[model samples]
Target: MDKKTHFDFVTSIGLMILSLVMIVDSYRMGVDVGGALYASPGMLPMVLALLLLLTSAMLLKRSIRNGGARQNLAGFVAWFDIFRKSRMAREMMVGALILALYTFVLAPRLPFWMSTSMFMILLMAILKATSLVKNLMITALVVGSIYGVFQMVFHVPLP
Candidate 1:
């Protein structure tokens, strides 16, 4: 079996399931389009789920028609392949860990804007941003824009 096609198919199926779950959960939560668009709690999740479903369907179709990364993948899964093949694997793993920590721990405990700002700066540093001033400036701008759009404009509640 083509490795790329197989992986793509699996990922598509997984995403489809997740999308279905999100859609169902939103409906169960009484989120309905009959109400005003902005006030509906389920609108964003519904939209996101539909978008994911569409993308997953497209990926599934493409994978079925054209294979990706055709190679024998029957053997035991090589979990350390990233470490063996690339030098940036460690940094990538650390980034993922940092993201998880920020999401589960910091975001809930601290204010969203502050936590997000710290997370952005830390991510920039992790990605090898050399200048402290540049990283701070860029991260502040990004955090401000995000806060302004989500909290001020959209009026989404933040911790």
Candidate 2:
């Protein structure tokens, strides 16, 4: 089997197993605020577990259909190549840092529109969007849509 497909299969299986473990651990934490007829702390874990299970199944099926051979050390070497590329690795790291920044700095106190617009604009700049006007317009549209969904429909409190 091809290297990428082999890694995909292994990663999917690993994630599924991890999710199952999380489900069990969360279940052991018991329900939230009640013993029965109420959502538990287990709810999120169960949802994650189901998603992981489905994703893993799909990956496994794809690998099988592609006639992937057994993975080996060479497959791991191929996986390591993802880290060898400086540009890709930097992008991945920067994206993760941006997410952390949003969670900690923006989510707490900034107004929904302000913080979202800022984040979206920054994302567009990072992606090297061609046109300034187009980027601004697209960001406006996206922020507006999210604002409508959160404020108008769900009526959720926004920071």
For every model shown, the clashing-pair count is 1, 1
lDDT of 1 by residue, 11-80 (tens): 8878999999999987755544457766678878889999999999999778766644232222113423
Q: Each candidate's lDDT (Cα)?
A: 0.77, 0.75
Among all candidates shown, the one with the greatest lDDT:
1
Can you write out model 2's per-residue Cα lDDT over 49-122, one digit (the tens) per residue?
88888888888778756654355345656767767677978877777777777779987778878888887787
Q: What TM-score, to 2 decimals, does candidate 2 have? A: 0.50
Clashing pairs in 1: 4-68
Which residue runs does candidate 2 get wrong by more than 4 Å?
Answer: 5-71, 83-89, 152-154
Q: Following a full C-alpha superposition, what root-mean-square deviation does model 2 have from the true structure?
A: 7.2
Q: For every model shown, what is its TM-score relative to the native structure?
A: 0.50, 0.50
Alpha-carbon RMSD, each predicted model: 9.1, 7.2
